[model samples]
Target: MLRTLTRFFVYVQTESNLKRLSLCSAARTGSAMTEPKLYRPPAEVRGMTSLDKDAFTQTITVPALRVPTGVLNKIVKSLKKSTIQRPGVPRVVQETEESSDSRLLLLDPNRVATPSSFSEAEAEALRSFGVAEELHRYELKLTYDNLKSEEVLEAVLPPGQDVTSAFSRVGHIAHMNLRDHQLPYKNLIGQVIMDKNPGVTCVVNKLNIIDSTYRNFKMEVLAGEENMVAKVKENGVTYEFDFSRVYWNPRLSTEHQRVVQLVKRGDTVFDVFAGVGPFAVPAARSGASVLANDLNPESHRWLQHNCKLNKVEGKVRTFNLDGRAFIQGPLKQELPGLLRGKASVHVVMNLPALALDFLDAFRGLLHQEPPCDHNLPTVHCYGFSKDDNPDTDVVKRASRSLGLPLEDRCSVHFVRNVAPNKDMLCVRFTLPKEVLFCSDEEHAEEPASKRQKCEDTTDSA
Candidate 1:
């Protein structure tokens, strides 16, 4: 029993020495006791003496002085002007029954040249306050854990290279376009962004535009789960779409709202090339009757789904047809009846890629001899242009397609800049009366040059 008790005491002393040496190791490295140990484990019974030489350069805590509560505030204020108070660490207070008279003052002994010998001025000040030679020792906590994503990336990214500050957020996915230099650190940058931003569960980088026919782009998952179904809220309406299958641009929110605001209750809207009814559903909700059409089966399905989702199915008539067929069929039949009631009719052609050429479909559309009124359908044609004067460019293309001068009759609105030199423009004009009432002779007399030009535009788009 005596031998067991002696062995236990020795073990306890060995454990205590091990803890002391461990703490001293941490202090030398300027690291906190609670910080993660990234280095390999020290050899058994040898403490942290086997740590790499690089570990010694790591930040560690310095010993501090505990001053009386009465002098704590004054000493802290004076220490701020002097070199005694450590940089970056806040002055901490130890709460106790004597809290009002005592507090802790952390100091960086590493800043002094002769760390073993105290400064004359510092020792004199401490001696005046009855301070002892013993100092409070503990690991210093760093503010590194609270850094922002950009700050964390700055430390890891190579010098002279900039990080992308802008990223598109679709539901839980963050879409970024990183340069070639940034690809190497893409995973680390993505993880840091996910950690700093709440509600983002995934990060994806756009590789390139792969499917031009369907407006689909190829993207690779940089971090997190690979769920592409995104729920986006635009212009007060919620839209759920398979981001991988359908085309949804959050940048068009302003344009969608602008056109929807123009239509009053009881107005009739015809949306050609409408992908998922970003305009149609909103117009229907505003009490306007909408005829929404899309060629893509998936987009058509989602458009119908959204109409039901927004509870506007009753007001919207959906169709899956080519833009020209939709214009020459449903719109042709619906216009006369709608015009008889003297209701405002709007034709929305939003496929900027080919909508300008589709304007030729309006030629010889209606054969009605005399519509007792002059309420012609107002067509909103969207197109893309790379000209310096995009407004004039769109108007000229629109006029050439219709074979009529639209300079005086039309109004052009600049939609947006798709790229540095390319822009999207909306040309608003009334469908020409002659084309609406296409007599056989006048239809035959259509300019051959104008018809060929329209065909050329379609082929290019």
Candidate 2:
């Protein structure tokens, strides 16, 4: 069974909209000075007024502070003071930063001391004033510390709160607690689902559960219509999934679209870790012949199904094999003779977080001579920024490992963020002429010092 994990952060503040009411004490029947009678004024006010009983009235101005949208609405409804004049913008009651806790409640002006916990008194106050109903209407923003607190538990509400129903309406849902390592899968899956493109079909898992060997389990659509159901068989075990629980990342689809736009007609595109054909399908649709390969057999099955679903069977070919093995195995023997040295292959490594480990395999595909023909195969290596240094260091390390120059010819394109503090970037370069000519010299030169620096930095982080 797949277990879902979520984290939430909540910040409490005074509401931005505050109701200001003016009330006068009840009149005295007989006394030295009679008190004024209190009366509720109209909802809308024309202008400010002076107190009738006071000889002189003083006006006070207060500074305003921004408050959470959820907290602001509660304040306005609870206070039933008469509106003699239009209410001004709410001023911040207090502006002090506090560490996040499980539950927080702001105090009423009438209260002598603010409550520290969600006590019975606080609950009664909230219930009496109907504040809980208003809170349920808006999603709250939580701080990091609050999200990780033991007392706070995240909850998921189905569309319209269909608590007992299995099938219902489709709407926006939120999934949190995605760790940094799992973000790529989350992002890539999220993109396809949100696109809602008829040409795309995707299955996403909100949970992250890597197998014993550190491989992520494949996602399958369990109980939808024929076209919607995702079928998969792996290691003699079959699993089913639903579309409602899974989320699609909008950013990943945009990136995929960008890559498709870059391709020209009749180009051959290579996707190393082409899980379920996110890259392949788009490339094929753009009129490029796509060679999609993944080590996971389940992924290859989905890739084939996706190709047919998108009506791009003729343009895409799915291969179930390790990326490194595919390059050095059958493809290596067939490429030289099949293309007659005129292959214009464009290799795409979208797995930047782990693409650095495959630099040698990428170098093997590039041409060994100068005036490099565009028809000849070349690599577009992708990787993430080093933790302790700028992302250029990733390019430097990969280039040096492949026995290439650092700055003269190589180009680095920094893509958008795949996760917090991590970016997707591509390094494009051609193999140097010296690659074939100075074999002995290349071997004799010591490995670039930057390679060690990268390993050390990553290890430390």
Candidate 3:
């Protein structure tokens, strides 16, 4: 049966299906109405053949079953229902003297007549219809397996150059960080990404992080629609935010879950540099009351929106304030109540850029209080380190920020690597009574030169 099916392909290959094809002006520009040639069909088929690159216009030879000419219309109908029938490719019929009672029914090749491609149900259907092993013999071409993202991109992009494969998908938008040389083909690359991936409707390129204060970056629409609002679901909670306005790193999802896992029911969380509440909302959903604050007003707005969206508004108090102010104001106000309780208290500072500098804000944060033995907020402060010993370097910076040694007081955890040399580190430490309650007057003043040097090294987020 398979051999007969294979032979049919060769028989159909010699015949023309130009009547089924949409004849272009160039194909029909002749005094005589000559049949149009197949759009770049294979000159010869020996073994398996790959489809033409121009899949839309390319034509392929489909095997036709030899049956009574009277039932040809019914056979066509059944084939159309079972396979992809291209209307542009015309059908052909042939008769031989020995097979005078039988006629060949040529159907659309692209539809479903390939020998190597058929479902079990299709095989059963063919057998039920008495499609025996005695039909014309020809080899059927198999369909090529789908290409990888990089492979598809390489074919579409310029040869010999490496295509950028790094992209962050925020909801339906694929965000790519293309370099300077790749800028000219940004639109083409974006379109290719959207095409190769499913469920992605938009593509954008990060131009630069222009407004550092808000963490809002400049982005150009490379492909798809010009919509910036993204709806992302992480840790089983949905977050809606403007991708162009707020800073939302889908990459930090693991980190968000890690921190939230530490927070249990009845615990209180203070998110100082919460951007769009990736940390705050999940922690709140985990049964912790959260006090989330961000320096960006847009982030503050979306944080509140997301809190309500998740129905965790009652558990979360949103604030738009600088990291220092958030520590000195709402956090300071809530610290007393948090300490008097039995529940755990977590302070999350995720802004790795300048969060180390904001550590000084924790010094003299709470005023006129004696050392409490009951509850001290465990600070989870993140910072980027580009040193030989990242752990030690992060601890040293945390110590300098707190105005106290953290070698014994803190535990440093490696978060992730941001770049070749830069590493993101999280220093988890119990807020020291000395630093948290130290009087402003007694706080040690650093030398002008020393403070300048500290500021220079800790400015990046």
Candidate 4:
């Protein structure tokens, strides 16, 4: 019993030494105790009347070592990872006077508060370099210019509130949808955004939800120049337009490219609600004949401009007409010719808010004569749903608008989250033959009744 107790005490002492060495090892890497914050904004700063850069100026103390210039290289090599690692903070303080033969090496105060904080390996290296065993104090003056946007915002906002300074960049414009609470600091947020992001000349925040009619939301310029024309590049294609007058969502660049990829050479594409020709121009560039149309005159004007800008104007035929008219007129005329041809046809309706409703225009679309070509046009329709089962909800709406059920026939793809409980989705499928070539009799009956008849007709004849 006496021997076992003695062994236990010896083991405890060994464990304690191991822990001290482990802590010393962590200190050498500048990750020891809680770091003293460098960003110190003025107290009682809440909502700023204006961004006061001078108010956030402060000074901080960090542990550093005064080393001789003769052995500076050796000392720095020995310190290795022990040097301070803050951005904009220099590791070595250059000697101001040419006569001075020594410089101060900045050390992370959190890790090297005492002389014994160095690990055994680092300590032996320092001693071999003939360096002093003591750490000196260095005053680091910090200001709003020194602090990062996130760090600055955190100090200004009330504790516990999330910092939402992130914005989507569209050319020289920074577009944001500021929350109600964040509106009070909108100017400060905008200024910080412009300061941090390079090449951003203007900042704007959406005032309300996107307008359903024109699809462009009202926005107020928060900071910088109030230029609304934005030039943005996506998927190697550059487009320029008035951001305030036309609808452009940079987030949908991936979705735009995804649809454009499907249009192979010799194929044809019809962009029913083409806003600035994101789809039409790219598809045209890929050697596919494109017919692009938009009801918004501003969107139509820019669609033509973008097509020319991308040098695909000749490839894409532009039309300024309502979606239904574009469909019943140009699309109806083109579908017959495309049906008889060998190339694949694609119809893109990307107006997410009310695109599904426009699916009805395809019903009895080919009224003159139903062509025999089975290479039906593929429809890529986008919609927004707040339902738990967004996929099902989108498909149902698409089917309802088309007067045909598409639950099993169509493929639903999750696009992105527009808001809480709201999702933007894309439903893709070949336009059903029955819906496309619905006769007078077929149109008289309920769409559900025709689903069975259409299936039976395929089986019978």
Model 1: ten consecutive residues of lowest lDDT: 452-461
Clashes of each: 8, 8, 11, 0
lDDT tens digits by residue: candidate 4, 1-461: 55345444643443342101111112224444334454346564555648888888778887888888898888888786778776577889964677388899988666676778888988998788888878777778877777767666766776777763446678999887666778888888889878877799998988766665567777899999999999999999999999999888776888898999999999999999998989999899999999999878999999999988888888999898878889989999888878888899999999877788788888877756754538899999998776777789999999988888998899998776554345679999999988888776676433321111111100000
- Worst window of 10 by summed lDDT in candidate 4: 452-461
Q: Candidate 3: worst 10 consecutive residues by lDDT?
A: 14-23
Cα lDDT of model 1 by residue, 45-90, tens digit: 1122221223223345556667887766666655553333423446
Candidate 3 structure quality by residue, lDDT tens digits, 1-461 = 55344334532332132111111224322221123233223323211122233432233344556766555565555555433233233443555567766566553333333443344654555566665423342222322123334433444444455554466778899887776656766776677667666788998987654354676677889889989999999989999999899888765778889989999999999999899999999999989999999988889999999999999999999999877778878888888878889999999998776677778887777766665767889999998776777789989998988889999988987665555455677999999988888887969744222111211221211
**lDDT of model number 1:** 0.68
Estimate the overall C-alpha local distance difference test score of candidate 3. Answer: 0.68
lDDT comparing candidate 2 with the true structure: 0.42
User: Local error of candidate 2 at 198, Å?
Assistant: 19
Return the TM-score for candidate 4, rounded to 2 decimals. Answer: 0.82
Shift of residue 31 alpha carbon in model 3, Å: 50
- The most accurate candidate by lDDT is 4
Give per-model TM-scores: 0.67, 0.46, 0.68, 0.82
lDDT of 2 at 274: 78
Candidate 2 TM-score, C-alpha based:
0.46
Q: Cα lDDT for residue 315, model 2?
A: 91
lDDT score, candidate 4, position 59: 83
lDDT of 3 at 447: 28
Task: Quickly count the clashes in candidate 2.
Answer: 8
